[model samples]
Target: MRSDQPNYDVDPTILQPPGTPVWVADEAWRELARAAARLDRAVVVVDCYPGVDEQAVKASLERVFDVVVSVPDEAARPTEEIDALVAANLGDDRVFGYITQFNVADLYDEARLAELRRRVHERTGPIVLMGWGARLAAPDADVLVLADMPRWEHQLRMRAGMPNWRCKNGDEDILRKYKRSFFVEWRMADRHKQPLLDALDYLLDTTISADEARLITGDTFRSALDAAITRPFRFVPYFDPGVWGGHWMQEVLGLPGDVPNYAWGFDCVPEENSLALDIDGVRVEMPSQNLVLRKPIELMGPGTFARFGADFPIRFDFLDTFGGGNLSLQVHPLTGYIQEKFGMKYTQDESYYLLDVGDDGGVYLGRKPGADFDEMFDELEKAQRGEGSFPDERFINRFNARKHDHVLIPAGTVHCSTRNTMVLEISATSYIFTFKMWDWDRVGLDGKPRPVHLDHARANVQWDRDTDWVTSNLINRIDVLEQGDGYRIERTGLHELEYIETVRHWFSVPTLRDTQSTVHVLNLVEGRAAVVESPTGAFEPYEVHYAETFIVPAHVGEYTIRPADGAGECATLTAHVRGTEFPRSVSGEDLRFSGRSAS
Candidate 1:
């Protein structure tokens, strides 16, 4: 079709002589078989054009189907007569319909189309249409139009400008065609929705007004807030300013102001991490206000930890700034190593829930197979001594992260969250974790090179040959279940103190049953559930409209849950001590641990 070439019809082989065309005999029979087979399904053959013999065609289709109907070619036939012919074919096993091959181009009438639809519904089987008739068939009629009559891939082939092989251009053409044809396959995303909401939310929230934070994490926060549809919540770690080197964005995460900045290199809130979630209509607040510790003696002032009690530890702040940059690739040590190495004073297990990512955005985790530790250490030694740079080529495995994806890290897994995106991090208690490696060789603002802990990192890195340190734990997954008022408690992991779970109901449901005492943390993951206590007045149910975590004491009373605030069906997560029974909330004491030592 292009101007460079003269037009020449590509003739099909039907006109070739029987013997001269080597492939004609086989092709003719195949066509005869197919055309004849399609005709056999109807009770009467309806041919708007009159070239073919009805009896012979009907005879040929006898083996495959019962009947065939063909329309009279002469225009002398009335619509009623044709209609009667169609009705006559309507039997228990046979019915009449139309095909696009009829070639009735100008026969499109709304009245006739409506009548056809009524007849189709009255008939038991489908109404078939072909070619031009297919274009006029009633919507209710089942239409089976041939897709390849004009060669469906004609446009694609023309776009490629080549016929021999599919090049990138050809592949793209094919992909574009596929995307256009399929529902989920080819649809373009509505990109502005999240961005617009994020901008508006930033404009309204005068407080927490760090422009860097507003720019980087606004989409993530807004998208999360805008999700009115009830579904499982996923957390990703895209906002860590620790990634992309020590950018100004990282500093903004800790502080509250500054804009047009990059990563906020330092954290301001050193004691506790916080998340502001608007669950349903409820505003549930959990602040990191209790992480201060009273050491043997305070150094400069009261330490952040000394002032806070047995509340939550491990704080992380929001940072937003530079899109892409360099950062260390690392993971944390497992629980055993932390207890052994840090004298049982640290706990850190985390995961990344990426909210946004770039085309080249990636995270590097673990080392590749056959990676020589000696060689890696040699590079590390040079980098640490300010001699050379860390080896960037060999050890890392990159993964293309995306929005609403959760990647769980159990610990001792060498990993780094990298480049261009916002992410939410969710993980277990205890914040102390070791960084395994760094890539860039730049000095910080302090005029000293950044600290590198190669020995500690190498000691905790998982080196198993079969393990895929990068993608092993990163996936979008959730478990949803239903149970009665007195719930089903099951153990999901091995540790004796794996976790504690407890459920208490504030309202009495007659179905509530008595259960044993077990130490556990109770979280209203979904609908509101009530707990009944003998001492305290009827307390409101733990409302979990958003991402809220709450602790349930070991011993609680007869707790019953009824639907709260007109909300039906509640979902809750209870993590409990191993091999223990559910505790009664009324007593506030666990007889099982009445005499146990604090340690």
Candidate 2:
């Protein structure tokens, strides 16, 4: 079971030695070496060793590994010891690699630590640590352990206080009583090492995909595809959708696993296509809703908007086999800059009316005051990469989304639907938004990847935004005074950044408010309503649909709408411009009124 060779998952309790000068205890060292043997990999213990029983431990570990031990003697140079182990183990195809433990705290001064890294990396193959020496000596080295540092250090005090800081709060006594230590042991070899590395490097440097290179750029499609599917690609599941009865992802997309939703733009989906794109909004739907949600529209070429818009602009298909699971996350463009910069077809402004959830499910929203953006982002980068500290406060503002609970998510807000929650999403016509942060770093079953938008998200993040411990400061507690049978306005705050006001009536209602030229995206979150053209006007139900959206085409005259039922409440959310910079339009005039124009 040695990781250097091949075996099952390694036991983690071997990290702390049993007896020592707060160093490698005999018992702990044996456990670690035992776990390494189980991994079929020789272990590398990088430490200033004194308490470890080298003779007894070596005999036990040798039984499992073709062991090349590197415990630098006082006279032996660290480089020489490393070279000997590397040459011995790497040369013998049958032998698993070495278990290296250097008293780095004393053996190497700063100069020697640097020298050790250069020499060690020169040795072929991956390296694992028995202790935390490499992180201090060579902070950037690709190192892995079963668990994170157990406690907060004075140096990490600032981050430790931050909510998003990956600072673990656990005691050794508590861990010892438990069966396993936090340390991890897994295979670290790449079957196609050189190819995977080269492909990753190329992807980091290039923007064009494989097919685009042949027609326009010189990008090799075969190479990129090969890189994407390389084995040893890590898979971590943040949450299990299928096991949770109903999941948030399936609910929001309004999909039934057996029956396809035609509005999602797909016709007669194949059985194989079911499992791949089952989650929603993906071409690869799978039977399990545990599908990855990744969109590479940014990499798509120009004129993509025109072509995509002609078909389904904000297209997504999802299956809710069992029902009662929904999602609760809303999105909006950062500031009307999306279409202006990236283009119209690339904005994601949507909302959710969560319908159902298991008793435990709830949505986690924006960061708390303690979890600052910079701190959260840093911890996320490290934790996701399995490199830095671990954030203890991975869950925040997670609330249950009962049926009919309406949440309007504008751009810049952080949110996610929990594992078991069903919700409806009413959104803008343009569908290009992203979750800037994620508490979990698990990838899905896709050999491909779940894309993270840490870079593009910067433009949309509201840095100074804060919320009450319970809800956002923007959640307006307005006093709704009924105006008339055909009119009611629920004055809600988009706050200073956005606005959400609900206009309702029996069937036909008229209001004389000045347009101020701000274009509004109107959607029927409840009963269906229509904007009937005035007598002698061009289009009836101008920008009308029962699906989800309609625009208050600027300069349209006093309009009338009869609800489908004609006498019941007809509701629509009026998403209007928020800042002083947006233009204003007078009623009945079309001059300065421009809304969602094509880029």
Candidate 3:
């Protein structure tokens, strides 16, 4: 049975080395004071991610040091200058923004930074420098600390009237704020943070409220990130409601009913999700991207890591539309388009694997036979200008869907899932790049019109993919690969042009599997529950219930999966990059994972 509360935490008890101290609440502040006592004149730099409570960090540091300096406030460029600088990248669009290549130091005033440096050198006792770009003020420090927060947490704080790093636009539109973060601030912050994380002495979890916070030594924190990829693990999942949301997740996952409906279940978005690391007894939550950035080879394997360094290519998420409205008609950019336009290496080439289908569940896919492209574009432009409503049926074809149906949706393909269908979207990680052609005349839950990118859609939509071509190419393109006693395997595709390969496995008995030197994502599509464990008892057995997505890291080279006792006929849908392969060795003992094997 599906557990209301699923497991996404990674403990790595056996793998963890001793002497990792976890300081919480008041103890966290005290530990910094204790560390400062060791130095004659301590220069502790608390480098922060934007949107973290810089004031609270400064207040806490004052309890440890004689004085705390806000580096960004003292030396950073004015809010207006920062805004004007990024205006070109932010663009005039309500949804899209081109990625900027500027570094965080670009926003700092060099004269002010030099002046702040002179003042800091004049101090005698312990000093604390706190703000987004504190490290820029003092490259060499007695102790370095990172006050961290994730992108999603930043979004929550923004919606609650919190502004960006140095801006006073607290009452700005949430989408505009997000666009700036995604296109401007986040890219710059990440570029600034990568080197700091490697040389850090401490990491403070600033996402938590002021009453109770978590802190750990950088060694212990880095060790935990290394320990995570040695076995199977999952990132913490987050859910959100939309105008076209559904009731399945709210009921099945036992989510709060306060929201109108649950539109998305973010199971494996590394950039936006977090991971809770168990350090002895305390829970330390950190962004999953930290692991991706730190250990790209072990987590993604050499194959995918070579193609996309520090970028998590594969993504899995849930789209719940049951008893709600249809998703907006959308198309994603092709790889060349994404690379040239947005500075991304790839695009959102995705597939919808139907997990649950209600009576009226279906999808709008491909163009109708002999549909006039010019006429459709004209109608879309007219609808955007409020001249008339878009007639979707005039251009698109509707296909009835069923449970366990897998449909491939490569970039440039026109597609949209309808109401009453639960979709598990297995795709590339760049989901934010989707260009909406129409929104079905529906407004968002906030009573605002969702932004449509008809111009971008016009440049990318595949006009060649007609109804007949879709039937032959994208829908239910399954091939029987292998079968044995109490086991069967089939290749469920993501198309030839797409890089991701998918397969479905059904087994009542224990089935041995190999990771093929690459990361693999799986969801329990059928039966009640199943357990994934090391083949030679390397890692502890991990249980997954129905509809829960789990990841098998590339370092876990070999593993086994079987239905739990009392559960029957379990099945899983697996996804991975296409070219990652490891030929079976001819002889010798199996190379199972161990605590000693972890980095």
Candidate closest to the true structure, highest lDDT = 3
Instruction: Report the C-alpha lDDT of model 3 over 548-567, residue by residue, as the tens digit.
Output: 78889898888888888988
Point out the worst 10-residue segment of candidate 1 by lDDT: 183-192
RMSD of each: 29.4, 22.2, 3.7
Model 1 whole-model lDDT (C-alpha atoms): 0.34
Estimated TM-score for each candidate: 0.38, 0.37, 0.94
* Residue 528 in candidate 3, Cα distance off native in Å: 1.9
Per-residue lDDT, model 2, residue 425, is 45
lDDT value, residue 474 of candidate 3: 97
Over 1-599, each residue of candidate 2 has an lDDT whose tens digit, in order, gives 00111211111011111221111223333443444445422334332111122233344334433533333321123544433433422332121222222223432345655665565556453343322232333344332221111111111222223111111223222212111111111001111111222221111100111111101001221232222221111111011232113423323333334422111221111110121111121121111101111111111112322234221222212212133332322224474656554334344544454434455655656556666667666765676576854453552355555543555556676665665444444443342245434434444232323345555455576655544623645333344434554555554433333333332222335333322333333444444334434323433333233324433322342334445434245555444433312244544443222211111
Q: What is the lDDT of residue 589 in candidate 1?
A: 50
What do the candidate models score in CA lDDT, each in turn? 0.34, 0.33, 0.84
- How many residue pairs clash in all the candidates, one count each? 81, 66, 0
